[model samples]
Target: MAVAAVGRGASCNAAARDLGCATSTVVSAVRRYREAGRGALRDRREGNGQRKVDERFRERLTRVLQRTPEDWGWCRPTWTRELLCLELERRGLPQVSVATMGRALTSLGARRKAARPIVQCPWPAWKRRRRLYELKCLHAHKPPEEPVLHVDEVDIHLNPKVGHDWCLPGQRRVVVTPGNNQKRFLAGALNVRTGKLTWVEGKSKASDLFIQLLWHLAGEYRRARRIHLVLDNAAVHTSQKTRKALAQLGGRIVLHFLPPYCPQGNRIERVWLDLHANVTRNHRCRTMDQLMVRVHAYLAARNAQRSASPCLRRADLRRTA
Candidate 1:
């Protein structure tokens, strides 16, 4: 309508007054209509007035992104989009907006991911021991009659696990967590050969709880002459009471300790990871009983799946006397 009024020789100011817009808006619209015809009068939805970031500028930005902000004499360890924009402008490139910088970075295949915590194993001997254990388990002439079980304990708190969930971009997800700090410790053993799991949940992770788990394992594998239990060097596992319990079991159970601070060596650690991902991550259980039910259900479902697999059956380790 503004363009039609201007085409009829109405002044830009008169058109603006009629259309309830600024004079500049009418003038610009008339110019667009004259230059590109009626197509320009219609809203261009493709570009949305955002300037396309240059390819050369993107390459330069990617190089900067590959390095920390400290490399550019900034006091920060990481780069924010605002910081990158400032750096780009400082380097005599086009003054890019933060949103444009983000788009450019994403186009360059860069992503925003949380940093994972890593602990470098101080003892290289642990790697060698782990490799040896794998070889013995995999390529032995005959399967070991005794089951090899990886044992570990995981503490589940009443507090909700803060994790990623489907939500609108730029919106934070709020998970309701109770003030009560009630916690349960699950002492679990994963059978390496049969892929079976046996676990006991307790209010506290103590030597007594550890001893009880050991007894439970003993009863679970009573037919086998000996069971090889791979575990970590937690204080409770090596305590005097635990040793006494092992002595009482005679030669029926043997404990193999992984190197200190080496959780990756315990296969049961992977089970805990799966458990958290399936039952606990982003979950808010109302009560301790509900949490226990969820945990038990997860374990039971896993055991059922394993039991169906013919390859994961219990090994016969008995020898003729």
Candidate 2:
């Protein structure tokens, strides 16, 4: 057995040391291998067992990966290994281990990811009432057909995300070789009421791109009676240059910012979730042009058919225990 292990690429000295009989015992193992064929070294249980994610699972894994978290009523897009293990267990394969669950996701070309940051900031009594009053007034004044748009930015990477495949949990990642020399960003907006999406490629999260995204909305929404923008308090959103650019729009679009640290109120939060689930999971772009192309394609396709994924809605937020 020791010689068989060594012949299969184990170090000879290590093999001899492990078997603990003698180097000559390894010679016996080798002779047995020569006489009895490869099966001489097979363990007693070798042919009697199978792994959990054997042939029966491949189809189920494919369908599971293709479905969004919202499709299953999960309140988040990203799936944890625990979630996967539970899925397998619920399907009557209770033997699936967490490690095996991870392997299955990797084999399906999905990356394990944490939930995105989503916090609803609290407002002081005064500001809270003032905003509620403003919302009430706007609600009363708005025509029945008016719509609200929520806008935000999300980042795409340079490298294919690393340490996400065939990797052990808790292993620290080494490096992220920048995929392309250039960096890119995305500016996105969504209709909160109608679940429509609008997105464009951006050079960076500059005040200019921010303003330009607003301009794009204005041009696209020229016929709407009023456009109320839901926003979070990013520095770019409040930049002087962006404000100047907004001023140039002649008040055609109204900005309704969530209180500080409160990004959950923006409907674009849901759009970004959908973006990753449908397009960005394990995405690879070797060049900046390729990155831009994929992003644009994703945006265009989603704009044509995107629904606000139920996972990110305010109603999906769990009540405090």
Candidate 3:
């Protein structure tokens, strides 16, 4: 109340005159304000926040990730969320949260390793221009009635993708467990227009395997007059061997490459996400053959959807597919 009065330019004598209270109350409030600023208005019991990890702690964490976990007095060589926290605590840092450790590891480049060696950090400028030109050509023209298939491969992990469980606020949940064991490989193509899908189980994602899938698609969509293909700029996709094979198809198809780092523009990317969510997440397959069975079932289901809600009008599918 005194602070409120002070805000209104109420002098101590003026406050006393107006409220019939002692002037000492207003004087004390103004004096506290002059000494402490706005923070004086807040309750003293409120905590500020968690103490930050110091530079010493961050360096220690970097060192921990640099070596195998076993080297740091741990029995195992691998790093796990639980083990990271325990190690930090053992090293004299206050217990760090799993999420905090995860972020720190990422900053220090300790997350997933690159899938393959990158010969060049950045591609040549002309290479970039050519890719851009191809993308521009793709984006400017609407797909003809036939579908443009962007084929890709994803590993089908054996482990079930457990859904997030309910938890009280501020509590933690298990992120990973040893129980997951099933895994397989998935090769698929996405139709852009109606968002239809077609894919298969594959032995490998090698260049030959990819070409075989293309051949299968060509045979399947034979009655279709033309196919516009959108592919990534992968070494295998543009290799001389792959080109010679694609060229053998005559002028029946047009192959266009998407710009690097621009997978979001590919509708098939979303299809992969959907398949992972709906079909693969809960699946637990022991063998490649068993995983193939489930994959075929999922593919048939997707095909059924395509038949019911045809991705594009025969004309549109013919053109923009």
Candidate 4:
């Protein structure tokens, strides 16, 4: 307005009065308009200026961030923002603040993620055992008269399973959980041939529960001449009572124990993950009975869909077989 008024032959003092500003302000605006045109009239705050660490240094940091701390001769398995800044200094690079380092890492597709714990096998024969198990799984599809099955037990607590969920920014989601310490044990078997699930829910995963699951499996695949059951080496599975129960089956049920600490070799482990993701994770059932009902319903729905459901199909034992 000041510039337009001045352009129309109004005096600087008159233009300032019309725009509600001092004459010096009007003179400054006129000078800016003449020097840089109308864009200078817009309000713009001054920035903090260029980053301390330039693009070249950030490129180097990205490469270092791609690797583990141990890869750089550090004893630690992971990297922290503070440690990363220290590393930059040690490597003769420009030092950055922890906050700045975090931003740089994020721009390079890095994220602050929790490490997933894995069971390590210290046994020398672990490789051989794993290979043997893989071989069994590979050949499990053969022999149309018999089918292979992977069985395992998963424990679900009355406490709500906390998992990721979308929420408002800077807010956390709260899930209601039962105060009483109650748990339900689920013993389940996945059929490699048909992608069917045979399961039994109980209070405890004891030898008796395992035996009952085995009987259920026997009843499920009654037409098969032999059932090749693959399971983990849980204490209950190899107990004296379980041995007696196996004896009663009379060679109809052949049990194959996976290598110790190698849950990855058991295909049913994937099924349990699917169950938790679908029926339990981020879910809050008011009562244990309600939780059980939901679990059973989820299992039934998945079984009905069979290969059609994404979760069931993704974890399909038939693919492993």
**Which TM-score value belongs to model 3?**
0.48
RMSD of each: 10.2, 14.7, 14.2, 9.6
Name the regions of candidate 2 deviating beyond 4 angstroms.
1-141, 162-181, 307-321
Could you estimate the TM-score for every candidate? 0.65, 0.51, 0.48, 0.71
Judging by lDDT against the true structure, name the best candidate. 4
C-alpha lDDT of residue 150 in model 1: 85
- What would the TM-score be for candidate 4 when compared with the true structure? 0.71
Model 3 Cα displacement at 114 (Å)? 20
Q: For each candidate, what is the lDDT?
A: 0.80, 0.68, 0.67, 0.81
* Candidate 2 to truth, TM: 0.51
Return model 4's CA RMSD, one decimal: 9.6
Model 4: which residue pairs collide? none
Models sorted by lDDT, best on top: 4, 1, 2, 3
Query: Which model is ahead, 2 or 4, in terms of lDDT?
Result: 4
Better of 1 and 2 by TM-score: 1
lDDT of 4 by residue, 96-146 (tens): 888888888877787778877887765568675876667475455558678
Residues 1-321 of candidate 1: C-alpha lDDT, one tens digit per residue = 989998899999999998899999998998998899988888776666655488778878888887889999999988889999998888888887888888888888898887768766577876857755763564243246777888999998778677777889889887788778689999999888778899998989999888889999999888888888888878999999988999999968887777777687787888888778776777777887777777777677678776321122112101100
Off by over 4 Å in 4: 1-67, 70-77, 85-104, 125-141, 307-321
> Which residue pairs of candidate 2 clash?
none
Residue lDDT tens for model 2, 1-321: 676587888765677888776777677677878899777866666665776687678667667667765677778766667876666566777467787777777777777556556555577868866775665466456674566767888887666544344558777545545544566788878775556677766777888788888888888888876678777778898889988877888877788877777554455777777666544555555566755565565555555555422223222222210
